[model samples]
Target: MKKIFGLLLVVLAVFAIASCVSEPAPKKDSPLDATVAYPPKILEHKGTAWGANPPAWLMEALKGYKFVERMADYQGKIVVIVEQDGESREGAELAASRLDAIPRISTLMGLRVKDTFAGAQVGDKDKIETYMERVVKVASETRFSGFMMEDSWWTYLQTYTPEGKADKRTYRVIQLWTMSKAALEKQLDSILKGEAANEPKTPEKERAIQAVQNAFYEGF
Candidate 1:
């Protein structure tokens, strides 16, 4: 009886040790669950803005790359920047594929900014300035010149309840502003040179410039 009791105690001790051994926490389905210093900011413009954390698979794919910054909701459109070290067409293609695997991400445009620019540290003033400077400097380099601004818009039907009655509304508006690195440089130069005022403008163009500025200075 004593030997049997000792055996049971040994088994319990083994179980206790097993329980104490920590396993890595399971990755969350949503990227929002992952801890980030600067959480995603609201993409303020018009219409309802919807944002969510990236999935576990995305997080894994983004590993070894520069960083998977927060996803933004620009008036119902989603935008994300996946920066990678060096310039690899193959790598970018693979990354694009990974991003496309996500349904929401696939719908929007993906801009690939290559080489030597790490995202600024959260709340670091000098780091932020340095990062932006580097981005601009890189932009100025003639070798990096695939920047273009795409003015693409789409409308969708939104259902809502008004006074207990179901109603549907169709929104017709330009929802996203995606700029290439070259285009971004041009806009930034225009803004810095006090030329944005001189250029013929629309509300959407103004917002796009502001959004790009904010993305650099404040992070997505």
Candidate 2:
């Protein structure tokens, strides 16, 4: 009886395997006739392949999302330059790219400048520049340009959006600026001089700043 039961189980397994193998696959669609829906249109343009998951045109303005520095012609003189995109305001995806790019450049500048500010003696404490973070932030907020010749220097950012699929909103800006090493030194000089000239007259200034800081911390 046990031998007969084992043979029956083997036969049932074979039947199940045969049934699976015999089941047909779904048929694929084939064109009924050689009919074209629309005219053949060019899928390539201006050195870029146009239709292969085409990127937003604003992205084309940047070579990549990394912080980039290069020497380029500035009023006929090659100069040290670092470029960052203004925070974009288009779709969240493109804006995220700009947001990512902005930090890399800002952090590079912030860390380098902060390093320069380090190791000053107690006498040089009067020359500390505190508004650099805020100043770098302002470059993202609005459109402006100047050639202050080393103070403001020849660096100027043009806030404009790349055409094609991007909205016409002014907030979608391309901020490209060139700064030479000489410009950085000149900027530092100006900051040192300005702070020295306007050193706070009273101790209350420090107390007031600390109070504001404490208030924010306590609130948090």
Candidate 3:
């Protein structure tokens, strides 16, 4: 009877071990696991996006105004956004000449104009959209990193024109700003370095803009 009792005790101990082995261990929190959603690296980009627009006529008329034959070292990587709205040739010429006269406008501000342009016609319906798309395309095709559409001229014309269509023309022009993206990395680098930090941050975007304010100021 003693031997049989000892054997039964041994059998119970084995069964107990087996039951513990079948159950899974609880999962513990890992320190590294919590930060899986964080981005691998931060991208610091320059914020201010300078813009310029020529009349529609010159934008369409001028051959290479839309293209960047040689990329200038203006405002670091702050992309220069230029719009050649070539609707009116004569007006476009006047605008371009005036814009060119403003020293450092192209280099520091990153905005330039080749000329003034005529507003899109009412009967054409899709003229403004088509023209703006072309402007965006030209900028990209020429490897320009950013874009800006100035409908200031268009607004003036619409004031005298009939309702509905006046606002219609300007809406597409406004939409261009959202559609464009420019790199300001180079410009940001210049401003963040030294004296450029002293400038006021009026436009929130300009807060991050770092570069020579104009061509005259030399940044060390």
Task: Name the runs in model 3 displaced over 4 angstroms.
Answer: 1-87, 99-220
Instruction: Evaluate model 2: give its TM-score.
Output: 0.26
Q: Model 2 over residues 48-75: C-alpha lDDT tens digits? A: 2222221232132233212232212243
lDDT of 3 by residue, 103-218 (tens): 22333233221111122222322323333233323322232224333222221111112211222111001001211213433332333343233433344324222211222123
Order the candidates by lDDT, highest first.
1, 2, 3
Task: Give the clashing residue pairs of candidate 2, or none.
Answer: 150-153
lDDT score, candidate 1: 0.31
What CA root-mean-square deviation does each model show from the true structure?
A: 21.7, 22.9, 30.8
Please list all clashing residue pairs in model 1, or write none if there are none. 31-53, 31-54, 32-53, 147-182
Q: What is the C-alpha lDDT of each candidate?
A: 0.31, 0.31, 0.26
Q: Candidate 1 residues 1-220, lDDT tens each? A: 3322322232223223321222223344556655422211122212223322323323322331123222332222223322211133344334433432233222221123212223533233332333344444433432322322222222222223422232443322221223343444464454333533543466655654344455543332
Whole-model lDDT, model 3: 0.26
Window of ten residues with lowest summed lDDT in model 2: 151-160
Candidate 3 local Cα displacement, residue 24, angstroms: 67
